[model samples]
Structures are given as structure tokens and as C-alpha cells.
Target: MAAYQDTFTSIPLSELATLAQSKKDEGARFINIHAATVADGFVLTYTFTSNETVTDNCQVHVTADDVVPAISPLFLAAFVFENEVHDLFGINIEGIAVDFKGDFYQISIETPMAVPTKPEHATAVNTKYGATVPVKQRKGEEQ
Candidate 1:
């Protein structure tokens, strides 16, 4: 079996929507949208299937305050993935066909997954008897 060549590119946040539209016009189908929070900013990867044989992936780096334009205008199915990225990563995505406003998952915490979560920062658990118990830290765990 032949391996597929994946084309990866990083574009500016300002060009996200336009680039997506161009790729869509080139007959690419939206596959998925993913994001990760870094010390400097957030990194987003948008994957597309140009055909059965080729996949194209684009990455965009933006600060936490940048408002990323939604590609749902070009790909309707993108709204779901875009919303998931917004809800979890806390990066603002504007112009979504169906915006969830960050309430898609009914999560109690806001952007809990945006910043790096430390094991030592886990929430305290309360016993059934009304006693509060701290989370047990494993040995060699970073403080």
C-alpha cells in the first residue's frame, strides 16, 4: 500500500477563513479542527481531505484574545468542530452558522482545558459524611 503525503502549512489567523474557502473551492472536504494551548498562544490545526489520496492540514497561531473567523460559511459541518474547539480551548470563533456560545457541553468551568492542568491543582473531593478530603498526590509528582 502506498502512503499518503500530508501537506501541512501554517497561516495567519487573519487568513483562516479565506484559506479555508480556497481549499474548499479546490475540492477539499473538511475533516476536523483541533486546538492546543501553548505558553505563547493557542495553536489550531484544520484538517481537510483534498481527495481519497491526499490530506491537507493547516495550522494557525493566535493569542488568547484573537477572534478566529469560522469556516462554517464554506463548510457547514465545520460548525460542530469549530464549536468544540471554542468551547474547550476558549479561543473565540466568530461567524459560525450555528454558534454555541461556549455552552455546547454544559461544562461548569469556563475553558478548563485551555490552560495546562497540573495534577496538584485538582479539586478537593468531599466525602458523603460532609468531610472535605484533599486529592492524594502521587510520589514524585511536581508540586
Candidate 2:
């Protein structure tokens, strides 16, 4: 078996479409695009695979106001991931082959994965039972 090799490269947002086109010309399959919220903005990762063992990723960092170009023109299936990232992370992706216009998901919360700028929404606490449970009922506090 060939050793699996994965590589990540950071690129400017403007070059995303070019990178995708280059990868397609190289006979690589578009794997997927992933988005994550960062302290100041968001990071988008575009992944591609070749030879079933080699994976290449292109990462871009953009602020909420940055407009990202869609790669769906090169990879038709990229529309799904682009719409998802736009709907969930609120990234402005333009020129999607199949634009969903934010209707891709029937979610009530807009940009739920976006970074919270308000102080109230910045803190999160998770309890085993629930936040409503009295402190005395916790496992360590149980008598």
C-alpha cells in the first residue's frame, strides 16, 4: 500500500477558483469544503484527493465582509458545500452555479456558527444533567 500523504496550503481568497481549476486539470477529485469560526473571522478549507491516497487542501482566511468566489464552475458539486458554508457560517460566496439564496437550510437561526460578538453569547456552559439543575443535585454535591 502506498503511504498516505496529506498537505495543506494557505492561499489568498482570490486564487480559490484558480486553485480548484488547476486541481481539476490534474485529475483530482473535489473532496469537500469546510468552514470554521475564528476569533477574528473564519477559515475555509477546500480539500481534493488524487490517487486515492494523496490529499491536498487549500485554506483561506476571510473576514465576514469578504466576498468569496465560488468554485462550483469547475466542480459542479461544490455548490452544495458553498451554499452550506454561506448558510451556516454567513460567508459571502458569490457566483455559485446553483445558488440557494440562503434557503439551502430551513434553519431558524441565521449564521448560527458565526462567531458571537456580543458578550452575552460569548460564554457557554454545559452540564451533565442540565443548567437548570440545582447545584446540590450535582454528582459531587449529592449527599
Candidate 3:
């Protein structure tokens, strides 16, 4: 069996939607979009698959305040992932085809997966008792 390696390409946030469209034009199917909280902000990865075995990823680094352009205009299935990232990580994605306005999930806390940007915003978890608690108070975690 041949080994398949996924390729990741870093792209500017301004080119997110454009890149998605280009990938679609190149006969790639939109797979999914994922988000991870970083020290400075967030890293959002958009994945596409082509030729059944080749995977291409476009990564965009953005702060919480950065407004990400929604690609749902080109790929209708992207609305779900866009809403998920926005509701779960506090990413600011604009112009979604079907905008849920942060009501995608029934979670109590907003941006529960978001990394706190300030010292006063240290609380990163919500306890089962409906109380908020602070996790590790660090800018970035060492893996």
C-alpha cells in the first residue's frame, strides 16, 4: 500500500474563502474545518481531499478579534464547521450562508475552548455545578 501524506499550507486569513474556492475549482472536495487555540490567537485549518488519497490543508492564524470570511458561499457544507468554530472557540467568522448567530450549540459558556487573552480572563472551564474555574494560567501549554 502506498503511504499518503497530508500537506498543510499556511494562508492569510484574508485569503481563506478565496483559497477554499480555488481548491474547489481544482476538483477537491471540502472535508472539514478545525480550530485550535494558540497563545496569540487561534489556528483554523481547512481540509480538502482530492484523488481519493491526497489531502490538502490550508491553515490560517487569526486572533479572536479577526473576522474570518465564511466559505459557505462557495461550499454550502462549510456553514456547520464555521458555526462550530465560532461558537466553540470564539472565532469571528462573517457572512455565513446560514448564520446561526452562536446558537449552534446549547452550551452554557461562550467560547469554552478559547484561550484566555488577558490575566483577568483566566477562567477557561465551566464546572458541572455551573461555576466557572480557571485552568492552567499560562499563555501557551507545553506539549
Candidate 4:
């Protein structure tokens, strides 16, 4: 048993991507990257694991501005992880699928979107984006 453990570190997404590229250039594969946001900042995890065991690992937690925009068009899973981060932590990611709020949630009491009805994003984040059905004005001489 060891009394010390490896620590997590946070770096910008752009930097992380560059590092990944460099690693690939050096013939490393089987990489995984995950990002998380916390009360004080965010977390970025990078790993090159094989045989279901982590041999090379790195984790970084950083302040809001310290993150890198996940270049998700390269990796499909990055897109999903980013969505979960934005939905739960409000961390903004550029070029995200929709870059809005409110997913397929039930709008229940436990949901964060209804907290104050943010007149701006409430409409776009829903899975039903731009899905307004026609409604008619009724009961007037002008109608």
C-alpha cells in the first residue's frame, strides 16, 4: 500500500487535444477524456488504459477560464460528456450540438431550469427546439 496517490490536474481543452495528438504521434492509443465542473472550478481527466487497467493517467481541475473547448467532432463520446457537463454544471462548451439548456427532462420540481425561467435559454435547450405548433388567435372581431 502507498500513502500517496497521484493528483488530478486541469488544463485547457485545446492544450489537452494537442497533447493527445502528440501522444498519438508517439504511438499511444486507448485514450479516454472526461470533463467535470465543480463549485470552484472544473475537472479534466485523461487516461491511456489497456486491459481495463489504468497505466497512464492524468486529471486536471481548473477555474472556469482554464478549460479547453472539447474538439468533439473528432471523438463522439466527448460530445456526450460535454452535454452532461453543460446540463448539470452550466459549463459552456463552444460548438456544442445545441449550445442551449434543458434536455429531455420532465420539468419536475427537481429540475434546475425552472429555478427562475431564464427567458433566454428556456426555449432552445429543450429537445423540442423550434417545435412550436400553430395556434390561432380567437374570439375577436378582428379574428
Model 2 bad stretches (over 4 Å):
115-143
Clashing pairs in 4: 9-59, 9-60, 10-60, 10-61, 13-68, 101-125
TM-score of 1: 0.78
lDDT of 3 by residue, 53-136 (tens): 778888999876789999888889999999999889878899999999999988887777664544334432221113445455
lDDT string for model 4 (20-120, tens) is: 56655565543565554344455667665333333466666654444356545445445666665555544556665444443724334332431223333
Q: By lDDT, is 1 or 4 better?
A: 1
List clash counts for every candidate, in order. 0, 0, 0, 6
Candidate 1: list runs displaced more than 4 Å: 118-143
CA lDDT for candidate 1: 0.75
- What lDDT does the true structure give each of the candidates? 0.75, 0.78, 0.79, 0.49
CA shift of 100, model 3, Å: 0.5
For model 1, residues 1-143, the per-residue Cα lDDT tens digits are: 35787888999988887898798889888888988766566789999987656778899987766789999988998999888988876778999889988878787756656534433222211111133334465689766
- C-alpha RMSD of each candidate structure in angstroms: 7.1, 7.6, 5.5, 13.7
Whole-structure CA lDDT of model 3: 0.79
Best by TM-score: 3
Clashes of 2: 0
Better of 2 and 4 by lDDT: 2
Those runs of model 4 whose alpha carbons end farther than 4 Å from true positions after fitting are 1-14, 23-39, 50-55, 65-67, 97-143
